[model samples]
Target: MLASPLIEFIAREHPAFVHVPLGLVAALPLAILISFLTKHARPLTGTAFFIAAVGWASSVASLVSGLLWGRQVNLIPVTGYFPVVASEKQVLQKMLQLHITASLVGFVIGGLCTWLLWRAWRREDSPGFAERRHAGRRFWERGAGVPALVVALLWLGSWGFSGKLGGIMVFGNEETNKAAADADRAKRNDAEADLPIRALDYASLEPAGAAPERSKAHGDRWRRIWVTASGIDDYQAGKPMKPGAYAVMATFTDEKGKPGTEPGPLYMKETKADGSTAFLFYWARVPENLRKEVGGQDSVYWRSPDPKLITCLGCHEKDATPAK
Candidate 1:
């Protein structure tokens, strides 16, 4: 389902018109045939006319709706993924463009059909309207009916096929993609079980000058994440991680040129050997004064040990098993 209002409207309405063009195509022929059998069959001609008019109206509706719908769906998402099946995509695009051409063709055919039906009707009351009008009216009727029907069929068929291909994009990959995701996840799980979970040593920094070296190396990658920063956390990886939770905060330049900030914290309850959870907390933040603070402050801002805290599930929960 399209969340965007414009897309939603197009998606909803295209189907509505899909049937209209086809229905009118079906009704138009019946209308012309009945009119020829008896020019006085005003009811037949009127019904056909109504069908032709509505059919053409709906056909136009489908054409416009499809175009708008296509625009919204064809947008690039910015993620660096290549488009699959480029040629096929282009082919489908051409078909949609052709849908518009077909629509105009339908309009012309319907107009000419309606005009000929009227001409046939006018000959009805002219007592001898029959003899002189028969040949010309038959020709016009067949002429208008065949091509109009073809236009509707070809146009609607193309739109329908294009719609199916688009649908396959969002919802059709489920069977194959889901299976692949499941298989990859299973392999990862098997590997994590054999991997060693290393613990971070946050206690030592100044004596070894490891802090400055690490600080210079990573810069402000992790904001305000120093080992002795106000609120701190420690984790041991080889063993089940300590039951802990932490908030990762960072400063971002906002639209007004002033620094804006958002806090994203991850909470974790360590699992015991028996698989039970022990809840503990570790909150992280880069104080406003420490704007230039490097590796010891922000998550992703710095990358040294003292200023780093394992993110929930990101690092702490990564590599739980051995390699395949």
Candidate 2:
């Protein structure tokens, strides 16, 4: 989905589209305020109505672009209106939810404000307006113009806050910048530390079987085992893998007691220099129904020495034969 050129262009242009409606809405209050001070209020009120109508209309485009951009980045779910923020630690998701809410609120309030302005403008342009203009009070003071100004201010505030959030999302604030730097540093450290880089590219290893087989030891899921060149012979011979050898098992969930199309988790076993075995488990995109297995995480990656792998240790004290 991310590879589509049209989606990429629309997502990229979200920031540009928002400014037009925002600028017009920001200027709406001043136009309405000026209409109240003039005796010839028709022209000024008409101008205010035009600005409000155009701003509200243009906001539809802005909202669409923003939604598409959010979906493209995976911040917003494909099936939902708001992001699913499972926890407080999901700062980006929480912020995105608020940003979407604020934008929608602004659109609704802006629509109402536009209607009010249109009614006021029409009243000023009516034939009886000249006779009514002789009254002591201004036309706006007794009509929908005042209410429109109040609602316009509210519309401005909502979009202003939404813009602030959008800006932070685009350009990192101190907290986001620090988080990004820390993540980058950790990634660099992992690369330099020689931390199971082979496990990440397990698909490049030699396949141990002709096709996937059901593994009763692994939740009855279908699994395909792959081994490093140094270990495939030993694995096939039912001999213990030598030190410095490793194997990866790719698993798929079951359907009607058979292998399903949805992928499960990747399990890796590595024999260290001392012949001690270590395990790694990675699930890049956990199915929604299986989230409870990984503490409701959308994705997970855990290596040996992480307490989370104790469950794997319980089943295999050492390298074991593949389940038939």
RMSD for each of the candidates: 15.1, 9.7
TM-score of each: 0.37, 0.62
Q: Tell how far residue 85 is off in model 1, in angstroms.
A: 12
Model 2 is weakest, by summed lDDT over 10 consecutive residues, at: 134-143
For candidate 2, lDDT tens digit of each residue in 177-269? 776687578668776233456776889999999988998887688999999999999999987799999899999988987789998888889
lDDT of 2 at 120: 88
Model 2: per-residue Cα lDDT at residue 119:
88
Candidate 2 ranges beyond 4 A from true positions? 126-130, 138-144, 186-249, 252-324
Candidate 2 to truth, TM: 0.62
Q: Candidate 2: deviation at residue 313, Å?
A: 21
Candidate 1 — what's its lDDT?
A: 0.42
